[model samples]
Target: MDDEAVIPISALQHYLYCPRQCALIHIEQLWAESQHTAEGRLLHDKADKPKMERRKGVRTVTAMPLAQPQLGITGVADVVEFHTGEDGVEHPYPVEYKRGRPKAYQADEVQLCAQALCLEHMLSCQIPEGALYYGETRRRTVVPFDTALRALTCETISATRAMTVSGRTPSATYSAKLCYNCSLFDLCQPRLLHRGESVQHWLHAQLKGE
Candidate 1:
């Protein structure tokens, strides 16, 4: 795929969180912001600026553009710290910034792993791990790019790309835990749509009976 056709790395995270959410944003071009999203944007203010600095022996680049055309993925890493090794190789360690603490899902990890994959392809070096820094916790959670995570990232990429190509938005399935806090919850109206489906089905059955 060409550069223009590459999928955004963020889409993989959204897909893992909820495929319907991914479809709503990527496929249907819908968006709604909540306090959570606003906070996230504010937290990214520093990382969103492209800059480079060196601390100790580590070279830190913020808002680094990353792309792996082979994987058809592209995105900007919040921070990529390059640590030089004895072999004169600069090992890349990506750090993604988030607004909230760790969640029950692997979406955040998958997003970090996807960044590692892009770096690996671009730098031609193996990345063993990366990290997620949460604003609320003010700490970093290291994530290993193990086989399972790598597989899941690849699967998410494929699924997201396929959904984009198909141009089909998935139906909403309401889950209080997942949907309540979603920035797109009002726009998605999962509960209303799910209820509408039930009513439609009931009406269809009644008509058939008559």
Candidate 2:
């Protein structure tokens, strides 16, 4: 597949977060940055730089471009460390940087898994795991690329690709937990749209009574 036609690996995370948000950004070409997003970008500044360094038998690369043509997905990994194993082979271990603490959802994990998949295809080796570095916690959370996670990553890829191809934005459903935290909340207006839908339903019910 052409690079232009490939879906972004980050879309998997966004889709898992909210399908509407995913469509709004990827399909509708809309974006609004909140404090959270700004902070995240700032945190990524260091990792976004393209650099390579070797320290203590490990070679670390920052801002590595990753793509899996078969899966039609592409993205940049924040950091990928190559560790020399006992077999005298270098194993790629991707580490993703996030602004906040670990979420209750698997969005971050799925994103990392997608990166691992891309690296596995590009390097022709099995990636056993990766890591997520949370800025808030200043810690790394290890993520195992188990069967279930791989399955979920593939499923998310298919769903995100389908949504992107259809070019349809899902209707907004307001949830204080999700919507308010989203960077595009003002642009999405999920609460207002949900209210409109409620009013429309009420009007339809009145018309049915009449």
Candidate 3:
């Protein structure tokens, strides 16, 4: 109500995938899932359990709380590891748990960056990099927090907050690419919608033809 936007960190991933999809889920609170999403749900459920462990002067925690008050976004990370650097200062490293292998999208990186930003804002620390752990491959990929990623993190945060403040969901744009394994495929009817046709009217017309 204060005209300040409070967006969730996940919106950054949605926005990267599709603006309309992002708005639908975030602003309209609409969601329809498929097998892929279900699997992801289970994977996150397994990873989100809070655990406190120690290794070599570092403490690791799961389902760690994070926030960037200036950005007005709050969320939790899969794992937040703390280590003492050579200077004897405690540093935080965020490791994101993924259900699948590497994706060809900035969406994952954006999410990780958001978490890092939150840590930076909250702890007043300089987190130059983080790592991603992929469940499928059982590997860790390190991501550098360079100028490019930082800029994207800042930009996505701005866009997501702007979207939430308006409180209007984005309209679905017809894209055949979005149909693969999409539970909303039938509801969305990307095939017909992409052709600039309405499935309801087309079906009605077909019935008359019969």
Global lDDT scores for all candidate models: 0.88, 0.90, 0.79
Give the residue spans of candidate 3 off by over 4 A. 1-4, 191-210
Model 3 residue 83 lDDT score: 91
Cα RMSD to the true fold for all candidates: 5.5, 5.8, 4.2
Give the TM-score of each candidate: 0.89, 0.90, 0.84
Predicted model with the maximum lDDT: 2
TM-score of 1: 0.89
Ranked by TM-score, top first: 2, 1, 3
- lDDT of residue 126 for candidate 3: 89
Can you give the lDDT of residue 109 in candidate 3?
93
Clash list (residue pairs), candidate 1: none
lDDT of 2 by residue, 1-210 (tens): 865457999899999999988988898787888899999999999999999999888999999999899999999999999999889789999999998899999999999999999999999999999999999999999999999999999999999998988866788888999988898886777866653232334346669999
List runs of model 1 lying over 4 Å from the truth. 2-5, 194-210
Backbone clash pairs for candidate 2 read none
Q: Write the per-residue lDDT of candidate 1 for residues 12-91, one digit (tens) a residue.
A: 98998898889888877778889999999999999999999987789999999998888999999999999988887789
Q: Give the range where candidate 1 is weakest over 10 consecutive residues by summed lDDT.
A: 194-203
Write the candidate numbers in order of decreasing lDDT.
2, 1, 3
lDDT of 1 at 158: 92
Each candidate's clash count? 0, 0, 0
